[model samples]
Target chain A: MHTTLAWIDYLIMVIYFAFVLGIGFALKRFMKTSTDFFLSGRSIPAWVAGLAFISANLGAQEVIGMAASGAKYGISTAHFYWLGAIPAMVFVGLFMMPFYYGSRARSVPEYLRLRFDEKTRGLNAISFAAMTIFSSGASMYAMAKLIGVLHIFDPVVHALGLPTGYVFHLSILVSAVITLGYVYLGGLTSAIYNEVLQFFLIVAGFFPLVWLGLKNVGGWEGLIAKCPPGFGHAWKGMTNADTNPLGVEWFALAMGLGFVLSFGYWCTDFLVVQRAMAADSMTSARRTPLIAALPKMAFPFLVILPGLIAVALPTPTAVEAPTSASASVVEADALGHGLIPAKVKTDGSIERDSAGQPVLDYDLAIPKLLLHYFPAGLLGLGLTALLASFMSGMAGNITAFNTVWTFDIYQAYIKPEASDKHYLRMGHFATLFGTAISIAAAYVVASYNNIMELLQLVFAFVNAPLLGTFLLGMFWKRATANGAFFGLLSGIGAAAVHHGVSLPAGSVPGVKGAWINRGAEFVANLAGWSPRLPFHAYRNEMAQNFWTAIWAFGVCFVVTIVVSLATKPRPDEELKGLVYSLTKHDVEHGLPWYRKPEVLGVAVVLMSIALNVIFR
Target chain B: MNLDIRVPIGLLFLSLGGLLTGYGVVTHFTSPEIYAQSLDVNVNFWWGLAMLAFGAGMLHYGRRAVARSTAAVGAE
Candidate 1:
């Protein structure tokens, strides 16, 4: 599919880039100290913080992945928003924000150091820093790859007579430079402000696409009529893994994604929590994530509905293949499901099948809809919004990386007694270093199959068991520092081992497959052990991820509890403001009914329940 | 005192809204072909107006907040 952007579209995108850079330069005066640079001086208002909180998490993977899932899996993809996000967001706002904000920890890893011990803090800090860099790299890779696939810049390149070969590398370099410039100027505050702007732009960009698509498809009723059975329901075939598009049981969805992954990300991931922690007051900090939940719940309509509507539209005859070294044509099967992969020609268009039908690429659902539905000026706005989302995600990662690197790694380990100005300078250097590393990481991410699935797998390996350690440390005073650290290590090890042993048939590359096969044979021959472990066979990679997280969480929880019981624990006095039981309960009775976190949390939960019931 | 974000955000939106609205009006009578893809809805015009109104409200609130804080400081 060729991009449909005109000169007007290019103009709009230029204006957006100007506004983003303008905001960064405008906010440079505020960054007089490290606190302001990293945390916005902890004085951002709740609404601004709330929008930025959600927007920072909205990256290239989220926008493209959700739409792709909507087209592939139908309405069940809303589970990522409603079930996987809202509840955890509410829990963080109502219950977890006090420790995160009240204790005045510089970062999440700092909180771990306070609550657990040095080793626990060290593990979390190093892993979190690495994850942020990797995540940033992934976002960069996704944006460059997406721009290449959509050929959005083809017109400009052709007009300028530039070579088409360097488009992907150019996209990466341009985006990296833009992000680095702004982040270097205003730091986290710049990232946060840009994220808020991006949130508005994204809403404005996609609302029209959804409206036009729905109108063309004859509304919700038309969508239900055109799509396959069970496509309209969120929980219909969820009870049985084999019957659903997700191909995962309801238990795994609830326990693994809903409980482990959601809480791990929402509560502990510094990328998002840092936004809320920048709120002006305790009440605002507590309310920040709750306010974010409102938009989070509504995002399925903006992002996911376009994909569903794209699928409901009449099937297209021709499609473009992904621009990889091995470009493959994707063809539809007997039931109109496109999964078969064929070779493609060098010109980027799909090679026709034996029946003379051009293969369709479902991942292009949103971009194709933008091309088909939006007008000229609005198309520019939509493309700008897409670019804004990518930049916002990368900026968030870079900002988080700089903060963690400066405070957790440099301040704590490199120079513990550094002055504020010294750390602030270090933050600037870290931003540059982190951006360079992320560019390298983006190059490394060329091999990944699906952006969203890869992210989920990463979360399973890192965040799942980390959630268990945090859960025990916060509520249970008996949890020892040694227990938490070792438990986390074992949990990550469990996820890796599960992935290694359950290696899906023919999924591994040739070299890795040969080595793994040899290792399996040696183990079986030496110990008389079966090559395969006794685990339930999953239908999809997502299901495998869910099971891996579930097992990891169980192992972490059990190991932490057992080791804590066996070891000595920290005294209660030492745990004040760190442990829930030891901390004082500060109630805000003066606030109005709606301003209260519990009130809003309950409402958010009720709304989520209503959504589930409506689509069940 | 810290600068309120609303002022800058409001100004940015107001500028964008003005640009879009002006373009929409210029193109409405002269060139209808520009909006042929969106069913001739003139989306830029209506959305621009909505943004202008929102931006104005934010600017008003931000100014009032600044006034109140300045008055308190003078009283102190």
Candidate 2:
């Protein structure tokens, strides 16, 4: 399990750590008020906010998960970037930023309060705060497990005379301390600044790996030749869910991912929106997501290309993996696609499917490729880049949690009016506790992985409903508070019921779904149902996923409209800046043609469409 | 607030690039076989050079920005 690391690699990691901490110390003097600590005094540049916006999402799971998707689904995985995030990012910048920035609300949940009611804000604040800490913990657990698996710290373990098992504990402790140190010292400003630096470092590290890999795989032509049909294409075979690589047809893909999931996340998730909220002016805030969209669209080449390359290359029976995290012994050729290792169980044996074929640990695609190609010095840089992403993501989650807890939960509910200095102190205190709980949650994840998965699934179900609530609250002044509150609850309930009857093709009728099999169908039959049941087993989990989103959003959209017409509407005068139609839409008037978000929005969409065509 | 972000990023990468290039030079003379694993391309040297160029650009741009802001403040 030992991965080779030269002195140069250790030095590289140390220097990176020093730079992060130094940035924190340098920004410490500016934290005299809670506004500075939590919001960066709204003085950040658009580009910096933009980079942080993307970097906040560049967690270990995201990088690994995207690559895994690339390995499993081929170039179609880019659809997640091109179709899923880019449009939502543009919409948030051009359309949503006016309400978010103009309203003097400090947090997303705070905005909910101004637009809707305190009850709605409280519901969102509590759930968001809880999700961030646990998600951060889950990511922390993943990072520590990765460090332990890679055995990069074997020499340090030997030098310190610690047991091999303690490496995991040490990794967790070190990450927590480093993350807490910078965040506590300088708060949101430090996190945002470090994220921008990490953005460059990530590019520096991965760009080379991809270059070497493309060369190894004999360039684009060779990759196309080596891959299976449609592996290199984004739009091929997308008409039918059964044939589509993503197992969801075009309309569901467009509506479910492109609209519901994308807007739900990019527009409402405070983790990224907070970065934009830190911008110096309304114009910068409007530009933040747009600027982020440019790099974001190009990231598939950086992150997803490695997986495509890994599959195209052949596996050496026994790869002398330089940074071997998995067993060096390769399985039968019938088992694996390429250099990607077979999924191993807790007992350290390869996991095989019901078909007797080995299921690849697609998550290890990036790790194996890094080990297969990188030498010592450059290897260090790559691993450091990976570690930087994990830390950055952790810090992103904590920063968001603290703000929500401080402003939405604490300031709103606990102590209605605290002094500026007292609130600043509370911000630091929140960071400390948020991180501590994350550490504890990391241990909980290590023990009860299933519960964590279920929790994440529940969290996913809760997310798509948010965009429905936000869309109504922001665009429609006639949308009532009661409508929003009840509509959100109905959307979540619909997602649950949708999951109740549906199941992915192969999976059993359990937590994966179809738990309500016999009774609902029997009842429907007794009632002499006119048409076929739409909520039956889907082609795959992805098919079920897209439908679930559509169901939730569809339900919330109708319910909110129905309820709004029945209930009393808030006065239009009180909703000036918070409602889109009421806000000043021509604020971009003086900006040059190139600077306007609408122009950039069009250009970004066109570029992404070109990418879809090129890959297709 | 005064600390421009590009300065730290520039300085960090500058040192990192310098380290890699220096090490690459020493290894090219001392242990030539180390480059074999990385497809014999001296990634440390070439990529280090690329990073060095980028780092210096960031540093120069950041310094000019800081200077301009300071000059504006002084004028006021």
Candidate 3:
């Protein structure tokens, strides 16, 4: 398809990229020490950290992924934003953040060490870093693909004479490089500052698409006219097979995964956890995440609903659905039929219908809507929001990567006696290394069926094990080092086994029929040769994914707690130290009346009960 | 987070239902040709109102929370 962006639009994107780089360069002075680079020297105000944390979480992939799901899954897909994210944020704000901030740790891994043992902390840090690389890399590739589709960097691809197949990798490489350059130069301060700017734009950009799409689809009426029966219903025709909004298994999985994943992400993920750790006071840090929760409650409309509107509007004839990676958006009607639809592959090839006509790529829903519907200046602003979302997220992850590697791994293990200045330099070096690894990993990503599925798979294994170990240590005093280590390994092992075994036999619960099966006989026939196998693989992989891992977390947590009970407790001092991490009090210093363990414990329980109702 | 300026979030809700009602009235009087083309306008009026209501609800809750917190602080 021909490019939709005019030369001016291209120039605007270039200027945006340059501005981000300039911001990185400008903030270098603030990043003098390891503390400064890692956590913005722990001076970030609550609001900035709040916005940056939210911005960082809503990366390009999430915006597009949620939109794509909205197009394909309709209102049912909103559960991910509402059920999965919002509640999780509330949990983090009220419960998880207190634990994170009170611990007074540099990173989540450090918290793990205080809560569990040295071995678990080190292992979790490494696992988390690796997981971040996969997630951040996928996000980079997705963002790059979107930019390429929008023609922001199409000329560079043409000039390089690279195959269209390489565009995904090229996109990942460019995004990662830019992200790394800024993060390496400045670190968390630049990331947070830039995020605050990006958040407003991202919200503003969404309005035009939604307004226009609503207008074009004949307003809300036109959308309703175009939609199939029960399409607009938030439940999307899901019933007893799913007792709740999601099926029983899915609900269990959603809640279970929601519990484990949210706790892990809010409590342990360095990218977010470090934000709270950077606060000026324990209360500010504890409250920042909750303050951020307000935004989480409403973000899905700005990001996801536009794609749903895209489904109501006419599909663009110009673009074709690329592979699963390329097709982040889909038609709401086609998706309701339970068919994934023929999308553009990474190779930029299209499949044909029964009459041999080319299929429309559903992923172009948002872009096509933007091109045809949006006016000139608004278009540029919208694109900026998109770009900002990508950059802020990638930048934050990259900074977190550098901080964890430099402090937790390099300074702690590789060069224990390194000076602060030397370690700060090492932090910069690690940012470069992380970028390189992510770019390399992006190449293998194309072979994977679905980018989001792939991310959840890795995150499940990485997060579940760590979440189990930490939960045990925090709540159960009897949890010993041996139990923590073994429990962590066992949780990961269970998830890995479930992920592996569920595939190949057609048993994965949420895996839909392949895209090839969605088209007319002609495409369906082709789906036989290349087969629906690829798309099926993606479906199966995502089926029972995070939920499965949540179950694993629960099982491992129980086993560890039980096993620890049978074993002897550690010395009083050791136990007291573990307890102190949760209370943010010194061991030798007696607690004040308000700081009494019983008071805090009751507050925690009451908060959890309130959250349970709010989430439900 | 405390705010003295107050805007009734209920206005957002009134606009939602009000917009759709106005559109429905306008469409009723339009020519047949225009009416067919204007169906989308009608839908937008309705859904937009829904959105307006939701947004208004959020504003109301936010305002209430702020008020309560402020009251607590004042009492203290």
Candidate 4:
């Protein structure tokens, strides 16, 4: 069914868009230098930066993807925030923030150059730049696709005689222009300030959705009563892989997601780190992630509750799948699942699960519930929240891309001797360039979706290895440039090789791995004589992803240590601010106990653990 | 640093809340049927009012901050 919007909805959207542009327009005059444009002149408050840090990552993927996972896996998805992000954010705040803030590196890759060698920095900067653009574009594609599917603007567009197909193109164009307009005019300050606004707007929008939804579904306990056993529990069935919907046991979950992947994304990725780096002072910088953790740990409730409510509501009359599910509407209704429509293919045929029942389009969980529960006025706010998420996500990438390009790539290599003014001009040029390419990439994603998957897998291989390099480089002063460079390469190689050999169960070769030997049987044959060498396929793609990261981290960690021992160390004086042992931790003696990173870190961790226990 | 970001955020929310609350009030008086999808509750009225209060709070804090900064500058 086409979900049409009333004039009130249109008015809400117009107000939101106006505020976004006006903020950018307001900030344009203060963007006097590259530092202001790129780093917010190191003047943003801790709370603001903290909010931006989380908001920058809150793309369509995080909101929609988490909701989707919540529908399919139940409360198990909370592990992503509670077990995954909380510890990592706290770690970054209490441990890694000192080096990042103290080093005065303009970007994450620049920090690599200061700690590691040039080649390592180059490899990181290029891959990271490409990854950010692609992901930004992919999110753009998803948002546009969702807008088309919702058909919320169909009334106005159709009245204008606009064809249905152009909805995707119109959505993409509108988002791209607004994103470019803000980032181009005011730079990172604009992006960060707007990210803060987006954060609040998203809460303003989705919070009520969750509230209204829970009331309808009889609150948390009532919803849990309708679900299967362990559906509301976070740690249940986590002892083994097959018992849990996540398809990975507790050990793998802790080591892979909690330790390696979380640290990799939060600590190393420039998108979130940039926010911390923009803070006004070292203390604020360190506190960025710590403050962010407060909202982050509770985010699952806002993003995931709609799905739980959707699944728990007594099954409504089944809305038949787009075209071919007409024959099985009764069958779908009999399954006692409702609201979530079936996933359909390009040919409009219903996609089926292994049991031959229609597979729900879980990504539509949030959208469907919003339409079901919200009236015209609130519907506008909810849709605006979604649109804000997509734009902020894209803007985050654009800002990061321009900074890395201008600082790491242009000044470092292209023209080593240029006035600061020239470089500032280059940053503007880079913003235009990055946004243009991202728009092009969005079109590419619309055509061949596999490129996004392939890019994501590439990102997994790339990002997973870097945390090992950073850990060794910062903690082990002996980690030489050669060691870091080769160790990183070897880590990436090990990740690729492991993925190339072991496939996820029931999946064919290609994006899901096992492209090399097609099975673990072949790899196991090399050490087949020993029972311990019996390697089998992973339970799912996530299981494979976690293991791949583990292999990469392990190899990179060991190789970096060995190579560092063999190679000459960078002198202690050279490593002063960058290395943990060499650097002096700034004493915040004047601050009260509650203001300390240690205090905040402990508080955040305990709160997250409390959540796990409560949910468990 | 450029400008207090909270000021703009406050203004945006204030206007948004006003529009929503106005619409909600109109519908509350003229036609309550608009809230049927929302389980017979006037979400627009309630949530809009909540937003307006939040916006007002933010603006109050933001203005105080600006005033305090200016006063400190004058004292210096």
Better of 3 and 4 by DockQ: 4
**Per-prediction share of native contacts kept:** 0.41, 0.85, 0.00, 0.82
Lowest summed lDDT window (length 10), candidate 1 chain A: A333-342
What tens digits encode model 3's per-residue C-alpha lDDT throughout A157-272?
A: 77799765466667676667777777777788777767765675577557756866676667656776775444455543333433333333444445554566656666557887
- Model 1 per-residue lDDT at A476: 91
- Residues A184-245 of candidate 4 have per-residue lDDT tens digits of 99999999999999999999999998888888778888889877567798899999998998
lDDT of 2 by residue, A399-476 (tens): 999999999999999997879888898999999999999999898774322222233354457778888999989898
Interface RMSD of 3: 11.7
RMSD, one per candidate, in order: 4.0, 3.8, 10.4, 4.0
List TM-score per model, in order: 0.91, 0.94, 0.74, 0.93
Residue A342 of model 2, lDDT score: 69
For model 2 the local lDDT of residue B13 reads 90
Extract clashing residue pairs from model 2: none
What is the alpha-carbon lDDT for the whole of candidate 1? 0.81
- Candidate 1, A1-616: lDDT as tens digits: 2244666678777877887888788888879899999998988889989999999999977897888788878899899889989999999898889998988998999999988888888898899899989999999888787677666786666777778756788889999999998999988888888898889888878888898888877899998788777789999978898788888899999998888888888888999999998899999999999999999999999998887887787653334433322223223312233221222345745545457765444556677678666766677777888888899999999999999999888888889997899999999999999999999999988544457878888888889999999889888988999899989999998887666555333344221123345566667879876574333345767777888888889899999999999999898988888778988989997888878899999999999999999988
The candidates, ranked best first by DockQ, are 4, 2, 1, 3
Q: Whose DockQ is higher: candidate 2's or candidate 3's?
A: 2
